[model samples]
Target: MNYRTNPKNGDKISQLGYGCMRFPSSATAGVSDIAEVKRLIKTAFDGGVNYFDTAFVYGDSEKVLGEVLEDLGIRDKILLSTKMPQFSCKSGADFETYFKKQLAALRVDYVDYLFIHNVSEKKRWDELKSWGILDWIQEKLDKGQAKNVGFSCHGSTSEFKAILDDHDWDFIMLQYNYLDENWQVGREGLKYAADKGVPVFIMEPVRGGLLADKLPPKAKTAFDNLPTKRSYASNAIRWVLDQPEVTMVLSGMSAFEQVTDNLTTASEINAGGLTDNERSAYVAAAAAIREFMDVYCTACGYCLPCPKGVSIPDCFYYYNLSFIDDMASVKRNFAGFVGNGNISACVGCKACERHCPQSISIAEKIAAARTRFGL
Candidate 1:
C-alpha cells in the first residue's frame, strides 16, 4: 500500500486508513458478528493498512477494533486513532473519566493519535478551551496516554483557519471528496494545514457512499468513457489522492468486499497520480452528480447553532440522497445520524438561512425534507 510520512514525527501512515464507524451489523442490531468483523479487519491489516480510526461515540467501535487487533496479535503493527467526545464534557474531569473508560474499552495503554471529536465551530472550540481541553491534551501527552493530538472538523473555512492557527496540532481530519472540493474546510483548508506543516487525513472521500453507488446516468457515462477500467469508488478515491496535501484517506468499509476493493485501489494509486484525462473525467462526473442533487448543502456546519437545534445540512443531504437512492436507507441514516436534530425540529426560525452561503431557503428545504422522509 502507498504510505505517507507524518510531517511531525515521520511515522508512515497508510494511504488507506480504516475507519471503524460503520462496521457491518453493528449499528442496526446493536450487536456485531465479532468473527466477521475480525476477518474484515485482518484482511485490511494484512493488506498493509496501518492506520485504524475510531471514536468513543462510534458505538463499540473501539472495543471491536481492540478485540480484533489483540486477537490477531497485531496491535503493534498498526497506528490506532480515536477521539474524545468533546460534546459530552461538562467539566475538565469528564475528559479523564471518559478517556480512562475508552482506554479500558480498547485495552490499549496509549492511543497513537487522539482528536477532539467533531470540533465544528469556533464557539464549540472556545467552550472546549474554556473547559481546559488543551491542558487535558497536554496531560495525556505528558503521561504517555496519547502519542499525538489533533482534531476533526466540520466547520466553516474561517473557523478551520482559526483552529489551525491556534494550536500546534499533529494532524487534522476533514470531510473531503470530489463533490466537496469547495465545501467546508475544503481544498483551501487542506492546503492551509499543509502550508503550516500539518498532515491531513481525509474522511468521507465518497461523500458517505453517495459517489460510489447509484450514480446518475450522466456521471456513470462520464466514468465509463475513461480509457482505463476502474470502479466509481476507485475514481472517487484516486481523485482525493491526487491532492498532494492529503496524508491519508479513511474509508469506512462495511463489508469484506469493500475492504478488498479499497485495498486494491489504495495500493494502485499514489498522490498526484491522476492524468489530465482522468482529471477531466472526474470533473464531468462531479458535474453530473451535482445535477442529481436537489439541495446544494455540502453538510458543512456553518449554518449550525440553530436555536431550534435543527440539523439543516444533514437533513438536506439525506433528503437529496432519498431522491436518487433507497428511501429506507435514507430514513435509517436520518434517524441514526441526525438524532434529536431531525428536520421536524425546525421552528421556522430563519437563523440558519441567514448564515447559509448557498442561499438555500433553510425552512422551506427542511419542510420539504420532513415531508419527503415522512418524519
Candidate 2:
C-alpha cells in the first residue's frame, strides 16, 4: 500500500486507512459478522494496509477488531487508531474510565494513535478543557499509552480552525471527499493544516459510500464514458488522493472486493497523480451530482445569519446526502446540529430566501431536512 510520512512523528501511515465503523452487520443489531470481519481484515493485512481506525462509539467494533487482529497475530503490524468519546466526559475521572475501556476492548495496552472523537463545537472543546481533558491527554502521551494524539472534527470551518490551533496535535482527522471538497475543513483547511506541519487523515473520503456506489445516472455515465475505466469507488477515492495535503484517506471496507479494490488504488495513486482525463471525469461527475440535488444551493454563505439560526447550506448538504446514504447513518450524523443548525430551528420567515442566489424555497427545504433527519 502507498504510505505517507506523519509530519509530527515520522510514522509511515497507509494512504488507505481502514475505518471500522461500517463493518458488515450480522442478524443481531449492534453486532457485526465477526467471521466476515476477520476475512476482510486478513485480506487487507495481507495486502499491506497497516493503518486501522475504530472508535468508542462504533458498537462492539473495538472488541471485534481486537479479536481479529489478535487471532491473526498482527496487532503490532498496523498503526491502530481508536477515538475517545470526549463529549460524554463530564468529570476529570471520566477520561481514564473511557480510555481504559477502549484499550481493554481493543486488547491493546496502548494505541498507535488516539483521537478526541468528533469535536463539533468550540464550546465542547472548551468544556473538555474545563473538565481537565488536556491533562488527561498529556498523561496518556507521557505514560506511553497513546503514541500520537489528536482529534476528529465534524464542526464548521471556523470551529475546525479554532480547535486545530488550540492543540499541538500529532495528527488530525477531517471529513473530506471529492463531493465534500468545500465542506468542513475542505481543501483550504487541509492546506491550513499542512502549513502548520500537521498531518491530515481524511474520513468520509467517499461521502459515506455515496460518491462510491450511489452516484446519479448522469454522474455514473460521465465516469463510465471516460477513456480509462474505473469503478465509481476508484474515481472518488483517487480524487481525494490527488491533493498532497491529504496524509491519508480512510475507507470503511466491509466486503472482500472493497479491500482488494482499495488496495490496488492505494498502491498506484499518489499525490497529484491523477491524469488529465481522470481530472476531467471528476469535474463532469461532480457537476452531475450537484445537478441531482433537490435544491440548487451551492453552499455559498449568501443565505447565512438566518433569523432562526438555521444552517441553510449545512441543512441542504445533509439533505442532498439523504438521497444517497443510508437513512440511519444520515440521521445519526445529522443529530449533531440538533439545537443549533437543525432545520427545526427555521421559522420560515423568508429571511434567508430573500438573499438566496438560486431562489430556492428555503422554508420548504428546511422542513424537509427537519423531517428527513428525524428532528
Candidate 3:
C-alpha cells in the first residue's frame, strides 16, 4: 500500500487505513464474529495496512479490535487509533473516566493516536475546555498515554475551522467523498488544514457505502458509462485520494472482498491520477446524487437502536430509494423495514439527530416514511 507521512511525527501511515467499526456481523449474533473479524483484519494487514481506527461508542469495536490485534501479535506493528467519546463527558473526571475505560477496552496502556471523539462545533470544544480538555491531552502526551492527538469533524466549515485554528492539532479526520466535496467541512476546510500543515485523514470516503449501492439512475449511468468500469466505491475512493490535500482514507471494510478492493485502489490510484473522463464522470454523478437525494443521510448507524428499536438508517435508505427506483422494487425490499408497524416505532424523539454526523431530521424523515410507505 502507498504511505503518507504524518506531519507531526514523520510516521509512514498507510494510505488506506482500516476503520474497525463495520466488521462483518455474524448472521446469528449480529455482532462481528471473532474468527471472521480476525481473518478480515489479517488480510488487510498482510496487504500492507498499518493503521486501524476504532472508537469507544462503536459497540464492542474496541474490544473486538483489541482481541484481533493481540491474537495476531501485531499490535506493536500497527498504528492504533481510538476516540474519547467526549459527548458523554461532563467534567474533568469524566475525561479520565472514559480514557481509562477506552484503554481497558483496547487492552493497551497507550494508544498511537487519540481523539476527542466527535467535536463538531466550537461550542462543544468550549465546553470541553471548561472540563479541562487541554490539560488532559497534555497529560496523555507527556505521560506517553497517547502519541498523537486529533479530532474527527462532522460540522459546518466555520465550526471546523474554529477548532482547527484553536490548537496545533497533529491531524484531523473529515468526511470526504464525491458526494460531500462541497458539503460538511468540505474542500475549503481540507485546503485550510493543508495550508496549516495538519494532515487530514478522511472518513466516509464512500458515504457509508451509499455511493456503491444506492446511486440514483442518472448517477449510476454516469459511472456505468465509463470505459474503465470500477465499482462505485472505488471511483468514489479514487476521487478523494486524487486530491493532494488528503493524507489518507479510512475504509470501514466489513468483508474480505472489500479489503482486496480497497487495497487495489490504494496501490494503483495515485494522487492526481484520475483521467479527465473519470473526473468529468465524478462531476456528473455528484450532480445527479444531489438532484435526487431525499434525506441527506450517510447511514452511519450512529443514530441507531432508537429507544424503541426503530431501524433509523434503513428507514431513510428506503425512503430515498422510493424516489429514484421502481416503486414495486423499493416496496419489496423496504417491506422488512417498513410497510408494517416498524416505522411507527419512532416516537418523534430527537435523540438520533444529536449523534447524526449528517444532521438529518431523522424523526421527520421517519414520519415521512410512515405516511408515504407504512401502508
Number of the predicted model whose TM-score against the real structure is largest: 3
- Candidate 1 total steric clashes: 0
Clashes of each: 0, 0, 0
Model 2 TM: 0.81
Candidate 3 deviant stretches above 4 angstroms: 337-339
Q: What is the C-alpha lDDT of each candidate?
A: 0.85, 0.84, 0.88
Q: Rank the candidates by TM-score, best first.
A: 3, 1, 2
Query: Candidate 2 lDDT, tens digit per residue, 84-116?
Result: 988567788888999999999999999999999
Q: Candidate 2: RMSD over Cα atoms?
A: 7.9
Off by over 4 Å in 2: 295-375
Residue-wise lDDT of candidate 1 within 1-375, one digit each (tens)?
Answer: 999998889999999999998788845576667888999999999999999999987877888888888999988888999998876788888888999989988999999999988787788788888989889899999999999999998777899999888888999999899888988899899999999889999998987677886577788888889898888888899999888899999998889988999999999888789989888888898898887688877554557778877767777777887877778887887799987345777888787775554568988888888877776
Ranking of predictions according to lDDT: 3, 1, 2
Whose lDDT is higher: candidate 1's or candidate 3's?
A: 3
